[model samples]
Target: MSADRATTETAGLMDRMYRHQRHIYDASRKFYLLGRDQLIAELDPPPAGSILEIGCGTGRNLIKLARTYPDTQCYGLDVSAEMLATAGRSVARSGLSERIHLAQADATCFDAAALFGRDGFDRIVISYALSMIPPWRGVIAQALRTLTATGSLHIVDFGDQRGLPASFRVLLNRWLTLFHVTPRHDLPEAIAELSRIEGAESRTRRLLRGYAIHAVATRRAA
Candidate 1:
């Protein structure tokens, strides 16, 4: 399928899956989506900088980001219109419509310049999203290209569960599969390769004994 068609189909699928789930997504996900708060805390975007979140379901992270970094501009994009609708309402309810801008776009093909009138972002965050996306590597490349010269990319997602018990891993994977999530086993290597190709420095940490992977890649492009 073509990229546009694939994006459209994926959006439809997500909308169907989260049409009702979006209402309680943040609340339910808070329990198992570990390392998200850590990623947000470590963002440390520069003063008056810009932060963008890909696959920003329900705009939960964007709202938190705006509150955390009041001096910065925050933006988010999610393919599912249903999720964006909830996100829009949530942002407005929080009185952050001005500070938090949102759009409906696919992470793999979104244009930051077109969506947010910005060429690049100072900080890009992806929290627990890669596992649910099939073309996750492409999303990483797209995010790197959307980063400013001195920008950084932060990511947190389900890890390989190497440190956890084998039975636990099996059970967890089964549970995750029910939600269309598949942990990226080669996440660290993928980040290293992409960051190197983009002239960035990348580091990854295995958190919760490999239950989650937290990665940060900083660019020093001239």
Candidate 2:
């Protein structure tokens, strides 16, 4: 299928899935969605720089980012209209509508210039979204392409759970399947390969007994 059609279909599916779930997403996800706040804290955007979050569900991270880095501009893109609606409301409630902009687009193939009137971002974050995207590698490549020189891309997602108990891993995998989420066991390898090809600096850490992985890749100096 064409990229547009695929994006539309994926958007529809996400909207259907989160039409109501968006309400309690943050509250419930707080338990297992580890390292998100760490990722946010580590995001030290340059003064007056721009930041974007792919698959910014409910705008929770964007709101925090706006509050934490008052000088930086924040933007977000999500395929789900339903989630965006919730995110918009959240941003407005947080009184950050002026600093935070949001749009609906596929993370794998979005035009940052058209959506946010910029060709690149100083900081881009993908939090727990890659595992759910079918074309996650494409998303990584796109993010790298849109990263400004000296910019960084941050990612946090489910790990292989190698350190977790076997029974727990089995149960978690089964639960994730219901939500259409898959842990990318090869994520570290993918990051290394991409960083090598793009001539960027890459770092990754496995946290919570290998339950989650956090990664950062910075653009190479020109």
Candidate with the greatest lDDT versus the true structure: 2
Residue 174, candidate 1: alpha-carbon lDDT: 94
Which pairs clash inside model 2?
Answer: none
Q: Which ten residues in a row have the lowest lDDT in candidate 1?
A: 35-44
Q: Model 2 off-target regions past 4 Å?
A: none
What is the C-alpha lDDT profile of model 1 across 98-166, one tens digit per residue?
899999998988888889999999999998889989999999999999999999999999998899999
What TM-score should be assigned to candidate 1?
0.98
Query: lDDT of candidate 2?
Result: 0.94
152-183: candidate 2 lDDT, tens digit per residue: 99999999899999999999999999999999
TM-score of 2: 0.98
Q: Report lDDT per candidate.
A: 0.93, 0.94
